[model samples]
Target chain A: MPRFNAIFFKLALNSLKSRQGSVILTLLAIIVSVYVLIGVEQIRMQTKQNFNSTIAGTDLIVGARTGDINLLLYAVFHMGAATQNISWKTYQELTTLSSVEWAVPISLGDSHQGYRVTATTPDYFTHYHYAELQPLQFAAGQPFEDVYDVVLGSEVAHKLGYQLGDKLTLSHGLGATSFSVHKDKPFRISGLLQATGTPVDKSLYISLSAMEAIHIGWNNGANSNAAHSVIDTQSLTPKSVTAVMLGLKQKTAIFRFQRVVNEYRDEALLAILPGVTLAKLWQITSVMEQSLRLIAVLILISSLLGLVAMLLASIRERQHEIAVMRVMGASPWFIFSLIEIEVVIVTFVGYVFGLLGVAMSFELAKNIGLEHFSIHLSSNIFSIDQLIYLALILIAAMIAGLIPAVMAYKQALGVRLD
Target chain B: MKTSILIQNLKFSYSPQSPLILDIPSWHVEQGERLFLQGPSGCGKSSLLNLISGILPLTQGYLGVLGAQLDTLSGRQRDHFRAQRIGYVFQRFNLIPYLSALDNIRLACIFTDQQQDSKQVEDKACSLLISLGIEQSHWHKASHQLSVGQQQRVAIARAMIHQPQLLIVDEPTSSLDHQSRDAFMQLLLRQVESTPLTLLFVSHDHTLSSYFSRSQSMNEINDA
Candidate 1:
């Protein structure tokens, strides 16, 4: 290799080695900031990925007239309150659309503790797809085959400590508060679905007729309620549902079918594209994302400021050393370059360690998050935003060192050879 | 004798509004001249040496070293000239604490772009240490690990390693005891005698000036 400017590099290396403790401390501060930045970014990206993948293979979510965001909140995630509920007749009419390939009705109203209770058909387990079009897989037993049979998601089972053949009653509303449970008829846990790292992980799945069956004894016996009250397992009927998920035969006809469902005068219904509604949800949360990004940047700035302060504080102690180097023929610029080079080296090392920390954090989060919120952490760490963040860190570190570097240069200029 | 350093009507002030610290109407030193410039504390002896070496830009008048005008050179050019032609030994014997004595000596050669074989440089540095009465065992020790007297010897080795035309010694004996000071001055003068290097030894001890062929007091050089 060609000879380096030894006066430059040697001074930098020697200065760093002489103040090894302070240099290491500064490097550690940078590493911590980088770790936090990458950590927050990884969670944000993975959260979005998890949200988008929560309900795949569904072309449209048809529900009561509401904004696309509210429709998605209630229909798919079972979050927030429903603005409206589609009647059973509207769901039937949507199922009859020529463009519809398969339609799965969902009724959401109750909860088993914090986990939402979703009432749907067997097709939810058979035809439903999540991330990468992967259909739901049972980690324990089979999907619900009877009206009063229920399938608990992995999180719901793990959190509530429920097992196959366990019987549980649903609470009246979706909130955490529970006044009464449908204790007269409890649903038996027929299966536990594998963790999908989505809302599905936090929901209880039962047949629509089972939901209707639980409410059958109320309201003085309407025929619709009376029909679902019969304990003769084969004699129940689901009179109404909250919403329906539809997959189209031809994706090109999604808008046409959505319009068809929206024009249904029989009930106040709305058809929302899951992808479009996901984008809307992202918009609603964009402010939070921006604020988080800003906080990460501010933390990085503070870390760099700490680095600058540390380096500047050491400048006084190194003044004699710098004067010695100056007498040895090293220029003021050489000293400046030396300080800058140290910062760059530390920054590069911190960035590498930060990326490693992010990867490790993601691995840890993957396991815990799946068991908790069903959000899968992605393995890709070098996203464009992360690269930009790394670049910003480098620039910021260099800028931080500039203060000490300029001071060193000025001191060197006035240095006397006494 | 060839003029190694020449100062003409040179004046320096710490600030534009401050009183003049040094005002040398004229001074000249020949090659191989061991001139002991003696003065008490606050007498601007160090400031004059700084101006001759071009570490401090002359505020007024001209200075020439080895036939090159220092004031005409840019900061970078002046630094290169200083590295190539001048060596300095400070009062504290300021050697980088982490570096071995040999490495510290080699740093001078490295900066001057005067490549020397490590074995040859090590042999020369060790020989200098031995000549200075330092033991062989302390040659490879870090500068800080060595005693203050030993570190002063190492600083002398570093200043002489590159064999520059001018050697500036700044009160190297100030911090030494009487016996150590006498021994250090003897060893330092012997080394300077072996090389054709001009010596500008600044000190407050006028008794030490009798050893030099030429001597001047700062009181005589500056009217202050």
Candidate 2:
């Protein structure tokens, strides 16, 4: 630094020291706004990650003809009832296709306690994959093989106090007060799934044979099984299934397989590419995300404005100080740069506060967020997005500082030291 | 001869529309001369001091200080020239409020070329402060904490620290009592006498001019 600049820098520091309270308040406002921006952006990114992580390995989701997002919600997330179901024959035919490696048929529309009851096959334990192509791991026992055997996800078992060999009955539908129960063949807990942080954790799994046997004597959704003592397993078969998750042997065969599934002659069905559909889902909800971003930007603008207001208000009192440096032969540019330096100091401190706030918050909430929402937020301080935000803040601070800096220059050049 | 300041047919105003605030036909201060310029209030004494120091723009003038023509140089060049050779003491003793007395004095050399060895500058500053009746204990105190008389002495020490060839004193004793004003004048004249300096001390109090070699009123010299 030039010698005059060193002096002016010290002068600016002393000037700020004289008026520390207002500067501190402006800095606090900036810190809080930056904190909000970081929090909102981090959560948004991680939630999208968690959603995409839920169904990563599955190549296609096969469901009765519906919107892509609707199928995603009803089939993958258990969010809504399916409009229609595919016949068991259609599911079997899909398994025989040359592109298909395996297909897990999931039968829905039932609940055990409050958790969704899904009837799948033994192949589901081996073929079904969630985030990172991870196969389901058992916390206890193994996948169900008998008709009345059931497997509980970690969350369900933990919530309902179920252990291995514990017996639980299934309700006829998702209704809270279901009039029909499968009392003839209650299921014994055969396995417990390790926590996967997906919709799978909120559901119970059973064998497809158990589903067919439970509704053996039901006539058009009415339970008539009270007259029967036992059902013949050899004669029972599932009439329909809610959806099928398909994995292709070759990833390139997805487009052809999806086209064929959508144009099937026997069944009216839609095959959704999970990744593409998830992108569209994000696009539909981007309006809300944009609104949140707008709010964060507005807060930053207001805080920067507060900085401008404080500096502008102090310029009148600082004109004499500027004149003092001017009489000492300091240039107008020196005064201008000095005022800007003060702003940079304040803004840099605010940025430090923001970074630490976000870092400490993640450290505090990491485990809890993972356990509850499966949102694995990164604790790393500087992502590309974060760097962009910091750069934008620096530009804003410079702009804010430029106002008072220009005014101080003019005032110093205009005033008389005497 | 290389006179400290030379002015001929000088005129100045704030703007083109305003009347002239300063218009002088001729003026000159020779080297090693202690001249007193006495004028009443609003007689443009401060304006004249500002012109001689090149703080104001010279619109129509043949003005020179230490053989350098004033109007031929840009504003930045004039600032550099002022920092190099001229020392000005304002009417209010304008020391920065935030800095200590020593720091305020150091500011004069901070922009000048006389800043090679900081310890040499400190020793010279301390000797001046002691000779000007400022004790060693009060040299590091902020200017705001000092009395008006003490601040006036620090301002004088600051103006003299860089050892300028020309010293312009602009009514710096306006707030001092009679006893302190006489003592300040005595100390200032003694310091100027100790060196071959051209002194231009301006004030409305004509009684203070008795210590100088010569005296002149604003009406006698100012054409405007």
Q: Give the number of the best model, judged by DockQ.
A: 1
True contacts kept of 1: 0.73
What value does the TM-score of chain B take for model 2?
0.96
Say what the RMSD of model 2 is: 3.4
User: TM-score of the second chain in each model?
Assistant: 0.94, 0.96
Clashing pairs for model 1 are A197-A374, A197-A375, A198-A374
The CAPRI quality class of candidate 1 comes to medium
Top-scoring candidate (TM-score): 2
Instruction: Sort candidate 2 into its docking category.
Output: acceptable
What is candidate 2's lDDT per residue for A39-151, written digit by digit as tens?
88887887777777787788999999998999998787887889899999999999998889889999898888768889999888887787788998999999998888999
Lowest-lDDT window of 10 residues in candidate 1 chain B?
B109-118
In order, the candidates keep a fraction of the true contacts of: 0.73, 0.37
TM-score of chain A of each: 0.88, 0.92
